[model samples]
Target: MAKVQVLGTGCAKCGYLLKNAQVAANERQAGDVVEKLDDMLQVHEFNPSALPALAIDGKVVTVGTLPSPSEIRQLIEQSQEVEE
Candidate 1:
């Protein structure tokens, strides 16, 4: 299974991003582990310019914007394929 990490500061946007990511993962049947990191330090560990970032298996994929459900689903699908 792939590891999905949401890096944010616990803001409304951050929560929305996490929710969208979960929905996408479920829709895609990604079967990934989703983790939320609210600490900047931890987020920076993965992405130096972290701000509402999404990491799949420790690689930064999305940052800055809260992606739409469809976009997130595509991302999850791509990540799942890469894992396999």
Candidate 2:
């Protein structure tokens, strides 16, 4: 399963991204797990250069911008490809 991690401080952008991730996962129906990292310490540990960054299975995919659900689904597919 792909692990989608949204790193942010629970701001609007962050929340939007989190929702998008969930939407993407649901649409894909691939058992992807979407999670949010709001704690500064946890998010800082991820070491994202920008807020609202996205990571798939622990690999950073995008930062500072929200991608569409389709795009996010594609990302999850790519991550699963790597795993396989």
Best by TM-score: 2
lDDT of 1 by residue, 3-82 (tens): 77889889888899999888877776747678899987788788547488888888889988889878977787787788
CA lDDT of every candidate? 0.82, 0.92
- How does each model score on TM-score? 0.85, 0.95
- What tens digits encode model 2's per-residue C-alpha lDDT throughout 1-84? 789999998899999999999999999887889999998998887788998999998888999999989999998998888888
Candidate 2: give its CA RMSD in angstroms. 0.8
TM-score of 2: 0.95
Task: Predict model 1's lDDT versus the native.
Answer: 0.82
Instruction: At residue 60, give the lDDT of candidate 1.
Output: 88
Residue pairs with clashing backbones, model 1: none
Global lDDT for candidate 2? 0.92
Worst 10-residue lDDT window for candidate 1 reads 24-33
Q: Residue 60 CA error for candidate 1 (Å)?
A: 0.6
Off by over 4 Å in 1: none
